[model samples]
Target: MTTKMVFAQPQPVLDARESDEWTSGICDCCDNKPQCCFAFWCCPCFACVKTRKYGQCLCLPLLDIFGPAHPATLAMRVSMRHRYGIKGTICKDCAIATFCTACAWCQMAREMDSRAIPIALVGTRPTQ
Candidate 1:
């Protein structure tokens, strides 16, 4: 007599639809008042701070000033949408980055906060 063993694969417990949208609207500045105020008062600094929190170089957003179009903001928005699986297109991202740059940065910051994604601070050593 010969015996064979069978293994079962695990399946997801929930079939609930994953959210393919941003946690807050681009103009939902009231969702995060402090961040919105900061962005409103000094957009460049706010963008740089938010970019650093997103684990990129602290000065990455400053590059936006050199171009007529907000390249840094658009790139960051596209990257964030892709990373979070948010449903949006490049054209939309470009338009928002161009027309509502401050709001775009604020929305990105709120998304990062809501998702609770871990951020590694620069020059900080890990403890064993």
Candidate 2:
């Protein structure tokens, strides 16, 4: 059985998500600074169980559009849909707006460039 890493202090000493040394080695969110946390499987960030406001990541569009959803992300979707009713389902366009990734809506997670913070410009969906 896989046991989750529970931190007593709820704060990581060194934030890997904020580290900028490695493009993929460190956490993706650790661009400004080191993202110290007590987890690494799904992701390492300050928005984990300790963040108090973290109910779930709930962006199903990202999972569906991006493919190969992580367990944490899936959990967030379930919570967002069933518990909080954030959104039943979101499209790629919505996720891009929600995640501010309109310019970098990558098809693959590994293809996401940590440094490439696309200009957060608003997008208008193409007419059908």
Candidate 3:
């Protein structure tokens, strides 16, 4: 009987500091007037839609009522930035969530739209 020892090579690590910029500015809601109006007319509804599109439960946006520093919003912001490799810091996420929650959501939605990432396709995988 012969025993063989195999060595595994280390995988290359990408630089986390190299990140892309956001597709749209937080306050660029006017760029998409319909979505801007929808978000403005019924922010809660817009938030709910955004939450559901994020692959979370539709009611997750209800967490916003807990306070200005909303957990759901912060989590979504952080995840979106990470997923898209967008350049941002936790402090920036906190500021956006605390002060510009609606605009932030709108910007995220716009970013996804610009990227052609179907809202229905997120969190879903093709089955063989």
Candidate 4:
């Protein structure tokens, strides 16, 4: 079945091309790709997302909001972490994390609390 994306009228006037400023993002669980309507956010692609699923959950910091990985995801991850002077894996174990299962790396780190200096800013709310 096709999911229809919806949008609400903006409370404030918005640039007609306002969407242009936003990167296209579908939840990891979303099967719908840009091949279908964008700006039409449906519920998180629940069926599409799975726990411990590879290639889900990670978002581009400083670029888009909670969104899917982009084509430049690898570069983005490296550069963003570097920008933050964020060395080492954000996940627990201070383990080195390669690109795949980026979310898992972070998830495990959170669960173990083995995260290194400056807990990973990804995954959970900042620890108080």
Best by TM-score: 1
TM-score of each: 0.77, 0.23, 0.73, 0.20
Backbone clashes for every candidate come to: 0, 10, 0, 5
Q: List the residue pairs that clash in candidate 4.
A: 5-40, 29-48, 29-49, 91-109, 92-109
Evaluated against the true structure, the overall lDDT of model 1 is: 0.88
Better by TM-score, candidate 4 or 2: 2
lDDT of 2 by residue, 11-30 (tens): 33432244322233212433
Question: 64-113 in candidate 1: lDDT tens per residue?
Answer: 99977999999999999988889999999999999999999999998888
Worst 10 residues of 4 by lDDT: 17-26
Best by lDDT: 1
Off-target runs (Cα >4 Å) in candidate 2 are 1-43, 49-52, 55-68, 90-128
Return model 3's CA RMSD, one decimal: 7.7
**Ranking 1 against 4 by TM-score, winner:** 1
Residue 8 of model 3, lDDT score: 73
lDDT of 4 at 127: 28
